[model samples]
Target: MQLLLVFQGRKLRITVILGAHNVRDREQSQQRIHVRQWVIHPKYSCEGFKNDIVLLKVGINTSPPAHLPKPLNLFLVPSGAECEVAGWGRTSLTGNGSNVMREVELKVQKEKICQQLFKNYQPQSMICVGDDYRKKGVYKGDSGGPLICNQKAHGIASHVPYGYVYPEVFTRISYFKPWIREQLRKFSLQDLPGSPFSD
Candidate 1:
């Protein structure tokens, strides 16, 4: 799969490279899509790892082959909720990444537990999920994927330590719903002011 980024009415391709191990044939499995636009949270910070979420405006050139979860509108995911996470990330802690996307079920951990585990964890902006007992969770290469619960996007996979023992961190969608709506509104206004596709 590929991520599309449209800037100033020009389409830019962002390749999504997956490992070859999980695929039957790597060359034939590659895919691409055209994205109309994308907006990252204004308060996002790479240094402190805060507010790690982005909203993508996909174009109508092609529709997703499979059903996609819609964004959760002002919905708060409760602790212990079983959520599904899918990605082409590493299968094991010591293994190379996977070529085919894999999906796994994880339970959302309490905010207090996450804060205790991660010193820099921001409770208001983040959520944690994993199977600590089995050491199973999101690892390297899984960043920016969605955390789906109840057929809605509740979080975005954000961070995890080197080892897979700790719970994976995710950007809480509920906390930033207003910001996301605002950005989408701004984009709509800019594009609809006259010729919708005008540069």
Candidate 2:
């Protein structure tokens, strides 16, 4: 059977990747769009170490979400790392910039802190951020987007409650790394079950 790759004859129309609904809503979030290609993508997270992988793939919020839990576990780019958070949701309730996108600076916060502030809502491996002053933050349309830092993805935007000054909830990434590798290996035949790391 042939899979339908897109609707309206275009992936661009259906995909959330780099699209308008993903622009963030911060005062300085404007120019940050230039970093689209600058962040690391698995192959390298930093110099010399060469394993500073950081990227994200946003998807639609499916209904009856399978076995997924309410907290909505996500990826953890890493704690205390510097990264950018992007979304296409509104800067205010009115809506984000109509013409431009949005991005904001984020400092990965301690998982414990997140849990405490969120009434123990955070889970293992979760890295939270953006509970700062009442500037714009992620909203309903922004789910499944990236919470990047140090040019790597730390988490995905999982949930944001109403009246949130800024989005504080997120999903961790590192725990999923092994699962991602296993699938890649099976698909590409890149390595045996116990192969060493490679370039």
The global C-alpha lDDT for each of the candidates, from Candidate 1 onward, is 0.72, 0.49
Q: Which whole-number lDDT from 0 to 100 does residue 10 have in model 2?
A: 77
Per-residue CA lDDT of candidate 1, range 1-199, in tens?
A: 2455665699678543333335556565454444556777777777547988877665442434322333453336778899998887888778888877788888988777777767788877788788677557787878888898888777889988555545888987778767877986776775675856433
Q: In model 1, state the lDDT of residue 186.
A: 76
lDDT of 2 by residue, 1-199 (tens): 1122342477422222232332334343222222111123344322222232333222222223112222333433446566677665556665553335467776655666666656545355445666565365666565666776655555667665456645466656664566455554443442345555211
Please state every model's RMSD to the true fold in angstroms: 5.3, 13.2
Error of 2 at 141 (Å): 2.1
Give the Å error, residue 61, model 2.
24
Best by TM-score: 1
For model 2, the stretches where C-alpha displacement exceeds 4 angstroms are 1-81, 94-99, 117-120, 189-199
lDDT of 2 at 56: 22
Q: What is the TM-score of each candidate against the true structure?
A: 0.75, 0.51
Give model 2's TM-score versus the native structure: 0.51
